[model samples]
Target: MKTLTSLLLPLFFFAASAASAAPTANSILGASDAIRNPGGAFSVTVTLTEFQAGKQVDASTLTSYSRTQSNGQFASLVQFVLPARDAGKLMLKNGNDMWFYDPLSKASVRLSPQQRLLGQASNGDVATVNLAKDYTAVLSGEEEVQNGERQLRKAHKLALTAANPDVTYASIEMWVDAENNRPIKARFFADSSRLLKTAYYRRYQPQLGAERPTETVIIDGLDPKSVTIMRFSDYAARSIPDTWMQRDFLPRFQPE
Candidate 1:
């Protein structure tokens, strides 16, 4: 009886270990996403600073109000708040559709997620995104990668392919912290597998309900000298009305 018990205990332990080793790739991506943004409707202010060849070039600030939709994706209304020229301009993203509205011209134009906003920052970067809902993730491997702070972290690497045609990038290679599922870094790729930019997420701070990354450093894939720093602050949970996400409502929107 003792011999049999010992053998069963070892088998039980092995099974437990194996079960914990394999987590669904989508779940892993979701965990990382939670660390990037709160799961509920929220607003955040983003400051984008552009640099070229290690010299400061330009900067802008924007406020984003975002809510998760029934499809498990995010619908975002972004308002430009800085640089007198761009103030009152707005960007709306609902489902797979994106539009840019200019108050001066009263013109609403469609926007592609790939459209550059500032330096390495794109129209998609400022908006809150639920990547697990937009892409299919495959566990590529596990390795040690450098985080934004230049410290090495053990991470699970995922290769993500867009589930539909509307996503910002055709594919992405992401590294998430293996222990806590924090997003460490990612490389965005075009449809042709061309590297677009590499982003490192760091400066984590307690916000909303979780520890979220407060800063992102984006480096241009082609021009190693070009860099963009995106900083998030003033995060707060808010009730976003459905009307705020409408294209026509952009013209009548009032800032609070």
Candidate 2:
């Protein structure tokens, strides 16, 4: 017997096709090209531990980041990020699939339709799956937040729904800065009811001629006792090989 989640998979695929049907590249981009031009790979490390509403966590997550230029004449800018937890583990996306390889477990998980599920449902919404058919993003309003003593403007919120029929999401709202075209705060709910996941960004800096997120913290109710803090260090420009992007190459992804 198929589980409830798995049972819903086929239905979601069909629904994804219908919802995404006849949507051309120009239509997908809507009125802006920001999402289509996320730029090239970036080197990053993140530490995440406990972030309860009122609890202290003691763990750190160190990971690496990489992205590719998108397809077409402007496809290269449809960039992505690779955040690996260790020397032997990694998260990467080719064109249609997102691969998460855990060498310790000797298990490689691939999220198909690799463009939709980003920043969407389940696994605390931090698994970084790249399934393209899993989400539809709607730009919300805008707001201002006090970052230190300076007033910073942000995109306010975006309501992301699971594009797959089998998978369901409550709601995931991300606050991105309009001026900088970057994310500042993100929150996820379950069944659109409860606060299940939350992630926010702070401390931005220039690396590789781009303004990027430097400090990120993700805390989920699934394990409320822990908060994860990521510290991105040693930012530099260097090309990471294609073989390193392979699912089986996760165990050999060594940072230099």
Candidate 3:
């Protein structure tokens, strides 16, 4: 009886531990965000390319610097670097508010987070995202999604609703790899519950001491031929000044 009791006790404890370790929706989202934005301050260059009818239509590059605040929110500054005509334009995000600065006119205007930057990519898309902070996550279920090579990968699907009105999407459906917590795919939805675009995270590479997706492909739901690819590169840790987060300082701000 003593020998049987000892074996059963260990098995009972093991089952209890496994049940407690089960991940919640919010925990999964938070883990995924931490993997993407690992530190408090960082800078990366993103190249956005637009394709239509299987042909490259437009391309632009932007450098962005972001800092995470004590309140667990992020402030980012983006500067366009390519195509002379679009060069020098700046976008700044401090919390939920965002502003766009036109260097040529020296004017700063309020912008919506949903406003398109290039092709299917939105102004909000380029900014640093903390999903757990902005959205209320619910564990929808588990499913298999196709990877870049069209191979099925098991993932946990999450349905997210905006916690506040300031967010770009009214709701979002996301899939994270069950094994690594890497974001596999996402579908953005409008206020009317209409599907806006689908995004696929691919090309995992080492960046800032972590393996993360180096490329994000967004496909337009309205027009299947329209596609946007955002390539992330040149990631490095850097200090972002408080003044750069202000709209008034955008005109004088220069890319480092």
Encode model 3's per-residue lDDT on 1-256: one tens digit a residue: 5798897999999999998999999999998998777578899999999999789999999998999987897898998989889888999899989999998899999999999999999999999878899999999999999965466899999999999999999999999989889988999999999999999999988998889889999999899899999999999998788888998798789766
Off by over 4 Å in 1: 1-13
> How many backbone clashes can be found in candidate 3?
0
Candidate 2 lDDT (Cα, whole model)?
Answer: 0.49
Model 1 weakest lDDT span, ten residues long: 247-256
Full-model lDDT, candidate 1: 0.93
Q: What is the lDDT of every predicted structure here? A: 0.93, 0.49, 0.91
Off by over 4 Å in 3: 1-15
* Candidate 2 lDDT tens digits, 201-228: 6666775565656666656547654455
lDDT of 1 by residue, 1-256 (tens): 5898887999999999998878778889999998898987889999999999999999999999999888878899999989989998999999889999998899999999989999999998888898998999999999999999999999999999999988899999999999999999999999999999999999999999789899999999999899999999999998999889888898898856
- Return whichever of 2 and 3 wins on TM-score: 3
Ranking by lDDT: 1, 3, 2
Q: Candidate 3: deviation at residue 222, Å?
A: 2.4
RMSD of each: 2.0, 14.4, 2.2
Q: List the residue pairs that clash in candidate 3.
A: none
